[model samples]
Target: MMNRRKFLQGAGALGGLMIVKPSVAFSYAANSTVQYALLGCGKRGTSVATSFAKNTQARIVALGDIFPDQLAKGKQHFDEINASLGFPAIDDKMTFHGWEAY
Candidate 1:
């Protein structure tokens, strides 16, 4: 029963709303206390997670890596990042290592 013009206008408005600003997305993410258990602590994962922490008010809750050394590195990295941002260092128990970590 809807006319073509009305449908097009409604679709346009819906599309506009879908184009959310980056800040809004980050703001919502910032308030989340949801645990993020990263499966891998490799370069790609580290880079993406690092950027999110560095560029926004978001925090990393949990971290995991197959290798103990890499897990330590990730924990250290995020701990420093958190400290610089005035957030607390990640607790030792929050860092998980070994293949079973994932």
Candidate 2:
């Protein structure tokens, strides 16, 4: 068996061989995809969520909220964005009524 130092050196070299800068790794010539879920859509959630949806590489896949109104609002926000972007609206594939609904 190899010694600990030898094993680590081998592993590090192998891993380092594949290392790439973030900019190089994310070369945008190819299509990029980002998926996100929103658990809450209050003021803060809506703000961050709007930013996330605005990102060309990102899509909102799910939304959950304790309140029905908030959930609907979250859905509406993404629905409009998807509609404008020529994508299908993400509807309630699985809706939770409350804690008991879980």
RMSD of each: 5.0, 6.3
Candidate 1 stretches with Cα past 4 Å from truth are 1-35
Q: Which of the numbered candidates is closest to the native, going by highest TM-score?
A: 1
In the range 3-88, model 2's lDDT, one tens digit per residue, is 99999999998787568654565664434577777777678988888887786668877777788988787788888987887767
Weakest 10 consecutive residues, lDDT, candidate 1?
26-35
Candidates' C-alpha lDDT? 0.80, 0.74
Candidate 1 residue lDDT tens string, 24-90: 7456544354436566889899999988888866788789988988888888888898899888888
TM-scores for the candidates: 0.63, 0.61
- Top-scoring candidate (lDDT): 1
Report how far off residue 14 is in candidate 1 (Å): 18
Query: What stretches of model 2 exceed 4 Å from their correct place?
Result: 1-31, 94-97, 100-102
The CA root-mean-square deviation of candidate 1, after full C-alpha superposition on the true structure, stands at 5.0
